[model samples]
Target: MTPSAVANLAGASPLPAFAPRPRSRPNSASPGPFGPAPRRLAVAAPPRAFFSSAPYQPPEPEGYSSVREYGLVPMVVETTSRGERAYDIFSRLLKERIVCIHGPIADETASLVVAQLLFLESENPLKPISLYINSPGGVVTAGLAIYDTMQYIRCPVNTICIGQAASMGSLLLAAGARGERRALPNARVMIHQPSGGAQGQATDIAIQAKEILKLRDRLNKIYAKHTGQNIDKIEQCMERDLFMDPEEAREWGLIDEVIENRPASLMPEGLSAVDPPHHGGGAGANGRGRDRDMEEPSAV
Candidate 1:
């Protein structure tokens, strides 16, 4: 029952005393005790792809093209105004003897045309010329200049009337070559005396009148050259304001023949025989004719 008696009976010994364990140093290749050091990766990642661009291009040169192998050079001269003179250059290129004069003859425009033709002649001599006229003429001086250029062209010239050639237009038609040609059916040619305004002192007026007379002489001379008619006969015809159809013009020797079927005559220069210049009677009616007798009320 007592504690000593119970222990004696059980015969158990007290707990054994503890002991310390032995220790050793780590190897040289091993990492420190705290933790292993971080390792670096020698990776070769796939190559990257980026966008690239190309350079720009420029335009083509004159008379040339990347798409075309050959191109034609056209010499075009439009006689619309005096200051704007391109037709003169075209005329100068006409080494060909045949030429046609069509449409209204503005002062500056006519000068440019004559100058161009003369320029052509200066480069190369040509025989007589061909003149195709279709117009309601303009300035007297311009018309006269055209006449002179035609007369001195030094070759046999021909004129063909396709439409209405009225007023100073008639003078130009008459200046055609001896054996002039014309279109049949609708062709009409008219001849009337020179007309203009009288603005100046008495002396100036007198001078202007003298100029008119001189122009008349020049016109008569043109008629004489082409028709073999005297100045009186031509003057008489002009005085009454003659209008001739193709047949009448032929009978009067104004034209030699009528060309109805042909691809227009073309000279060495690129000019081709074509229809007469057309003027419209729209808002800008520049070619409308006036009755001279109506203005001469005092004489009547």
Candidate 2:
């Protein structure tokens, strides 16, 4: 029977048939059937090649190489590698006829002084060279080298003692300036016999002792020549360290004059003036006060 006739007979209306929904195909821009699409993270790839293709190597060391396959290595390495500025400054000072001996007297120091004195003598024999000394003293042989050179050189060397001149240093100062040695009012002076050591067999030690005696006698004669003191008296005084103030040094004929003023030419540029030694104070730069306790009769 027709649904419309049946409905009319039943006095009821037929309901409209429902349509089915269409299924969607999976796509790149669309979500999956399960839900929303999962996110994908980007990753970077490692490089296959380096900028340098050569095998790794270390840089070569510069200047001197202390390493050696065998033999003894030096405990100390002497180098003259100074900055250009220092070289320039020293060069200028050399031209000014002013040289400084501000440290211990030693072979190296004597060499430098000898070189400068020789140069000055060759350049101008009459040119006056001023040597400023402030040392506690050192090797006797080294000081003697400088002393003999000062007398041998034709150039007039004016030694000004700005601080303490001890042991062989005193001899050098007294011998300089051709008996015209000058000392600062606060300077100190000391003289003592040269001390030495011998390490060997019995005969070798005896020989060294004889040599030391001869050296001491020679030094005594030199000191006597510069100062009017009798050789015997000077020898006796040198047996024990003889300490003297500036005034006492002048009276002893170790120095000619005690100057109160420091000449501009004598002072080095860029250096501050040193304060005078205190009368009853602590040690000064030249070790004026400490000599009584600390002074030793070593090589100087």
Candidate 3:
């Protein structure tokens, strides 16, 4: 063959053949609309309850069905629940021939004092009993109950004022003692006419007002008799609350003497001075202490 024909034949090697790349398969376990079949996962089943189980049950009631069924037990619990310390102190004082009227004068308190006084009087009629008063005063009737009992008892009652004696407390201080009423040097005393509110018809309210006036007159007479003050002057002074220091109280005949130095025997073993006034209803009615503005009339 000629040289040109040989060159053409050499250059005429066939063009290399092209092949398409293979596509990758989708993962069977992956989540997709057009994915391959899913692979099963090995998961353990929950344990059966046949061996041990408890059925669902409703809760029990939280409160009692009838309070009356428990009777006075609940009342006793309630009274002592908050006043355990006071009750303990009171019991100790009673054993020591002492009666502490440390809060407001109230019906329940009067009853308690009266009962204790009677018991003590029965035990030893001639023994000298100490009546410790530190109050802002309360219901006049309740105070009068204690006052009358104090007077009726055969034992000699020595009233001692510590922090304060005001309104009904003043009455108790004056009438609860036999001869001389005493006060701490820093004690305060107050005297005022009985006060209260009446809710009723107009006529009934007027009647209640008249009754209160009459009760006030009786109280004035009692104060006058005890303090040697003229009833008229007492009435005048009592028209508004009159506060006095210990000396002034003594001068006014509210207290016979001011205790300059308290005897060790006068206080409890652990106490230094008088106990601070407890805030809640102590051993008194409504579980509350005295309120100066709300002092009620004796006859109410």
Candidate 4:
């Protein structure tokens, strides 16, 4: 019988049953080591595919000479492949007068990248930088690190999303400078509650569950701080796995404006005339993953 028909015949509610005393996690507002800092947060995704692409050898700009000659440095993180990593790109890009960070960001790698960027910027007082983001979204901690870094940087920071920036990625975009500088398109921007899986012995599994709850609470605080929405409202939408398009994100104060595309002139100017792929052994843009298997990333 149809679900509606059965409901009518039995005069019973058709909604799915909720388990009694359902296990719950703490909210992100709790004060603890796991709770996020209050400076404003943004987010990003992981590169689960690019890792396998042919080893990359970053190009060297010929006669790149003075930093002034090239207005900005291009730091592209296009692939989100597992074990490939984001730090590899961030560290190198930070050296440029103008740095652009983009690509599929993910996992613990994203956290490391943002941390390194912040560390570098903190040490270098003269660095002026901007960020370019295009991602689907991945690890929450990594996203948080990127967001925090943006707030701490002394130089002006701008964020522009080209294609789609969903999930944690959208959060990072929202964390950009307030007012006219922060812009995204009418493209879709998604937000949802954080989640993860655990597997272990029953006792260990129980312990893992507790940790997961703590993580959930921390994520709740991130939403509350950035969106200025009550935790309850955030959780309500999260419970249902909500996604927002560009228009909704802007209305919610998640983005500044909807733009079509970045001016071509905004492109990085400091590439080496004969620049090799940023990495030493990567095939770089070519469909060859062989070198990547044998490659180890260099210190940027």
- Higher-TM-score candidate among 1 and 2? 2
Estimated TM-score for each candidate: 0.52, 0.59, 0.59, 0.50
Q: Residues 1-300, candidate 1, lDDT per residue (tens digit)?
A: 999999886886576556766666555456877665556678645332111000111223666432232243344443444543343322433434445455566555576568756765665556445556667666666677777876676544556666777767766776665555555558887776665445546666677667667777776787777777788888888775778887887788766666554333422333333333334222212232221111111210
Of candidate 2, the 10-residue stretch with the lowest lDDT total is 47-56
lDDT of 3 by residue, 1-300 (tens): 999999998988588667889888867766787665778898755321110001112333677332223354211111234452223435655766888776666556778889999998998998778888888887777787888888888888888998998888888888755445899888898988877665546676677778778888889999998899997899899998899998998888887877654443354334433343344423323232322221111111
Q: Which consecutive 10 residues in model 4 have the weakest lDDT in total?
A: 47-56
lDDT of 4 by residue, 216-281 (tens): 777667767766778897777766456676777777767776655333223344432233434564
Using lDDT as the measure, name the better of candidate 1 and candidate 3: 3
How close to the true structure is residue 124 of candidate 2, measured as C-alpha lDDT?
91
How far residue 277's Cα lies from its native spot in candidate 1, in Å, is 26
Q: List the residue pairs that clash in candidate 2.
A: none
Q: Itemize residue pairs with steric clashes in candidate 1.
A: 92-120, 100-132, 127-155, 128-155, 128-156, 129-157, 157-177, 160-181
lDDT of 1: 0.57
Alpha-carbon lDDT, every model: 0.57, 0.70, 0.70, 0.56
Q: How many clashing pairs does model 3 include? A: 2
